[model samples]
Target: MTDTDNVSRRRFLQATGGAASAVALAGCTGGDDSDTETTTTDSGGDSKERNLKITWRPLDTLDPVASTDSASGWVIQQVNDTLANYKNGAVEIESRLATDWSIEDNTKYTFTLAKDAKFHNGKKVTAQDVVYSFERLAASDSSRRASFILNDLGVKHETKTVTKDGEEVEEYKPNSLAVNAEDEHTVSIELSEPFHASLPMLAYTSFSVIPEGIIGDVGDYEGEMSQKKFAKQPVGAGPFKFDQWQQDTKAVVKRFDDYHGKVPEVAGVHWQLISDDTARYTYQMNKNADMFNIPTSKFDPNKVSVEKTDDMGRKHGTYGPVRNGDTVNFGRVGGISNHYVGFNCEKVDKKVRQAFAYALNQETVSNNIFKGRSKPAQHFTPPAIFPGGASGYDEHAKKYPYDSSKAQLQKAKELMKEAGYGKDKKLDITLTTYDANVYIEISKLLRDKLASAYMNISVEPVKFPTLVNRGRNGKLEVYTLGWLMDYPAPDNFLKLLYPPKTDTSKKGMASYVNWSGTEAAKKATEAWDKIQANTKPTEEAQKARNEAYLTMEEANWEDAVMIPLDHPYEDRMSYDWIDVPMFGGAGRSRQMLNTAKFTGKRN
Candidate 1:
């Protein structure tokens, strides 16, 4: 798990101009980029018992609130439903549990739930369920407190003093509930202040609507309610109902026959957790697994053979490596999907952090390692990811280009010296990531690039969950991560670093990025506050937010808090049998889980 697992779900989206990786279908290697034609029509519409296949690194939890990783989000998507959702490659706020929704005076958002929607246990999806799902998030021990409760909805993070041993310490928690049920079918979310991007925030699985009857009022990340019964066996108004879960093995979700939304044609979905990349690809190659992303080795030089090449000079596995059959290539699913190197501000000082940022060249990584599959990003979040930011939006990426120039590198070396790191007094540190082939290659690159510049680094690969666990403790000195957007707004990117951990239990909170109390964080928060005050999603709001971020990001670059990597173009291949309804790269990672069906005849 990268920091996105940490959202450092980058706990994850990128908005930028990027190309999709070319897909070589079996030995055929046909079709231009982004033209696999998977989304032309809906597959599995014939109403049959076809099992939808998916691959993952295993789910952390089905408890939507506590589950921070994308794998967990995928599972939650099938088992639960949000008030609103982003479907069909757009963020249009389609009605789900809520039949209709409206905004009043830019402060109150009202959603009317459908009368027919029911949970797996036959409970009707009501306004009380909606209110309970939200209040539950603000409970005593919820990891999602900052993400949805405090940050997005705009509320106070209030704390009360309590006695610990003899001394009294502050027991901080989110000041919650502008969320209430106006009536049984109607749910209203009233923010203390105007939050322009509130609806988009509801589209995230983290803000998923769960049954109040099961979890109850005070949500628990541990113990009986959230984890024991609900996390493993969930009940929601989604297209699928939870069938069974065997951690690290598989999770089975069966189609709900009486779903309010379009019922999936498939009888069920098989979420198989394939840990090994080679084994995962092997399943795809033999068509044993219906879908999986193209292996990092196909694009990364580390695992890819040099001899494999297509006529267009692109690599095809059949040229040397084994080729998978008739794969569908859907290029560059939109939004921000950037990979970055984040410094543990507690251990790495400002000067050393800046030096580390300027030490390497993104072009080398973009051209060679990524093989033009991903754009080498220069900012933490891609500007185009935000609403009203497609054209004429100012970005901080240009300020710090991929300059491995002697002047810049020299400045970096000087900073390294200033930080008391040189040949005699070296800054020794270890960078950790999950044991994925792609991440291993990335860590290796960072280690070599930083070592060449004077920051002596050792790459340490751990399990995905462990990487996220270690991130919370600030054990990693310099770690590699990419943030995936929870929603298609600048707030999603900005909020990833917002809600600075100010309390004693801050280390325990996953949102604690180790950059709290820094001048950089203060400035970023100030700019974000200005952005939040804009009242509505408009061109003026986007520009104001963009300009404010420009100042924030410039300071961030100088502070060297996070080194921007490219928002690489993501490319993926599915079998011709696969029908990918939403293909916005990482954004649609979980959205298409319910609607996606396998219609093509299997041999």
Candidate 2:
């Protein structure tokens, strides 16, 4: 999920940030003293020693519980293994740490852990570890996604409202979450209600099993280390182990020999922090980085050639014979996310919001800014999971049009005039966004366009963390951000626009856009309520849910709570010698490098 800056797996993917080391080359040695050199035989029967160097943005946190952005998720996933994972390029769940699972009565889920799975410290994974992990995640004050497990999935937990520094806060009761260890290798979870997306939700990295009693205060077990130390150097049962993390520079992870899954083809992975798009492109072009995302400024659609598109819409191809005269492998897929400009509805008038939405051309912005790599989003939910699916998306999009044209401009001018802003009275506001080149460019374009509609917009680009903090505190009036899917479900996207989730009084995450006190909010909430009550498997129930989604979409559009921008395409370029796996659009944050191999000699 991206808020403008960090692309957290389900939290945020900063349009710019990632977690990587500052290594100059893939083969260079730079990590903790525990790092060792190893050689692996390639498919061609040739043995070579190499470290996978990848380009990434700055990471926010590595603590899985507290991680809400993709930059941190990218690294946390490497060091932690979840019970299940999405099949490559699909929403289908596949086994990871848990070999098999069973769901009974829709509310009871039992997972059998793989007996062979071992933590980085060589501790065998047990049912107790899984229980401890879930409990810790549920109770941690630092966890940004506690609600996902506690409420979304309906995990049975007890909470008490307490006053902290004169402010009310909800605290979880000890040993109340209905997660239990049935046996040494089996774990059982009881939910407060049946949820269809429970399995997929459990696949989230926040539920990753760590060594039992590794960190204290959240669980009954006495911990071996402080939570602070664990965040810096976490140990888990994933394919890779945390080796070193240099703040703002890079994070290195060495392959774990005791990993139960297929061992990594490379000795380790060197995540190089190249936040600058141009610098990252240069790093890959210079052969310093093996795999990287092609910057929009550097992307040439003419140079891209698609070989095939999978069932899930993942395009596999080659990039180009660029300035280096080499054609690199390419992959592209539509992200299950949307980027938009949100308004603090409490502060910004509805007419003003509608005027701004009318004045901005989503298609033009997406085409010009993203080089035609993204599709203009008419609704918050991407077409892949929009209501009744693709057809439902088309119907709603046509019913509510927000694209800019001569007519739209006229409407915007009229609305601005009605809102008491005209030639003499101008609506001046600052548009806050992450300090990324792409957002800066987008903000500038918006500023220029809105100026004609009697609105003077100032662009304020702050760090990704600051932008998120200000947004949560309702300190931002107008801001640009994006939401990547937490799961492959419509509710994940729709919930963002749900007024209650953005109520500052409720300490909402997206509270910058305070739309809770409006008629539109009530309508959207009603639709959301209908959706929750209609989760049965019957055809009628499904139809009602889809209709409710349409209602929510309509409510959001009519009120102009947020100006939906575009659905971005996830694209990547890798050196021809590397066999980089294509993850398609979903679960990019859970992308694992263990399967990546050096197929040939690197140039």
Candidate 3:
């Protein structure tokens, strides 16, 4: 399989703006400029650098920690630069004010400052600046980007009693938190324990280092600084700097004169927020947007480069280019995401869930609706995250093929009959989904198929915000949602459905609320806890961890908590002027600053 076919899920979300927290309106095509045609060569820098009109949905916020939308991320992709970034196959630590580093231990690391790395304000980036940037992230009240950093410093949240002077004070203290500036050029971070996810955590845009002076200059930086301010006017040590933001319309970034790395090829970057897929596609067609994502329906092979590959050794059917003559590139969108149908464990019975699962026609959805955009899935855990995941799942496929009118349906009917969900006793179920044409179609299709088994399936279309709230509140009967992995690893996926029982857990996004509270699943979650708790587990530890992941998946799936569907692929269109390798994680490609060069094409 080509990189496009066996697309790593990590890169897929980055392409589609995996951080999207809500729906946004697509950009309205500005009045056509056909009246004023100026001819110029398409070569980079041959003409004056014009404002780049990249299209995406508007973001909710720009606060690194709080903003989860792709629009916000695309903007941040320009203004902010991370300490270590993923590029060309590995995590390359940029010399963004920091030239080098030394790891004292698993819990302790020290970075050497780059004398020339300066902020947009022309202030020299110091070890103290790095320390301040981290402190703000740790104490911020917005989102939880701080927790990732604190965890990197081996700081665990623990409730404890301490004696201050002569009195005893009981409180919760963040464990092993200490940052010391050894000198003007070096800083050290001491942690309580070793954590594995640290490097990847730093890859997050939220952890991008900011000017220390900016924080103190603006008192109460966390409370006062809004994403609007950040998006409209941002300051960072990246190759590019923020210029202006037009709030849901567009934003601009110019090259930073003092950028420490190899200077960027382009002079400036611009963004046009477009929520509607068709509008975004049209912008690309009209040559307004240099790059934009397209849906499976409008995917045109004739437009761009396409390839097919088999990354997963298993027999996942060929997912690209039916004919080389077709111009549109076809393949899968990667990242750890599962398009699974989840049942409200509290409301749905096991028999009912299994019956519904059996009756659901995933092949039809994959073939007709998805248009071969996705592969039919059988397991809850996807192949990309878990090691040997494809191998383990290949065994299950022999037992279950895509068959809608077979013993599986018969079994479902028998289960429904036993559970009193038949012609005389139909169970009322409301399947909730957000406003996506594909998802809406899936819900309607399932509703029609379930009618064969005489089950009442009500299709409820809710707003995106309400959809998220309903899943978090555990109030929906059935819900359709997708999980794009934040990072590569089984832990990220496992943590979702298996958050701690307390309200303070991180798995709020998990749709299988029933399995999370169940005794067997809880036990599986505890086993995962033990694995993460280890200071430095041996190879055996990881092997055991993969085994645990399967245990968790089986525990949840056997209980009919969630049903796997398909892994959907996205179609992206870009003018030849926009050049970036399309086979990496989300952050790697599409960032205007990362591409060697991008030029506007006028046809």
TM-score of each: 0.81, 0.90, 0.77
Lowest summed lDDT window (length 10), candidate 3: 20-29
Model 1, global lDDT: 0.62
Which portions of model 1 show Cα errors greater than 4 Å? 1-47, 155-176, 216-226, 299-330, 386-396, 401-411, 502-512, 516-522, 535-543
- Give the candidate order by descending TM-score: 2, 1, 3
lDDT: which candidate is best? 2
Model 2, span 1-603: residue lDDT tens: 123321122221121012100000000012221224434323452313567778787777888898777778888988999998755534555678888776666667788889899999989999999988887788776777877887678788888988977888886776799999999999989888666577768878889899989998585667888888888889999988998887767888888888999788777787777667777777777776778777788888899999997655568888898668888888887777788888988889999888878877877877888888888778888877776565667666887656643227788889999999898999889899877777788889878877888999989998777888877777888998887766767778888777877876564354467777678889999998988887643468778878888888889998998888888888888877787677745646767778877777655
The candidate 2 region of ten consecutive residues with least summed lDDT is 19-28
Query: Mind giving the per-residue lDDT tens digits that candidate 1 earns over 1-603?
Result: 332111111001221111111111110011111112122223434524566666666777787777777777777887888887765434545667877766665566777888999988888888888876776566635445444656566634456787876777665453356777899899877766665566667777777787775764374333335445777787777888888778776777778888888887776677677777777766666755555566666543333333343322233331113374242433334445567777777777888778767766777666766676665666666644532242223333445743632225777778788877787777788888667776677778767766756777788988767877777765777777777766655566655554354122453343434676777677877876776676454567767876775666665676677776666554444565656553443354546466676667653
Model 1, TM vs. native: 0.81
Better of 2 and 3 by lDDT: 2
Question: How well does candidate 1 score on lDDT at residue 156?
Answer: 42
Backbone clash total for model 1 is: 34
Q: What is the lDDT, from 0 to 100, of the residue 3 in candidate 2?
A: 35
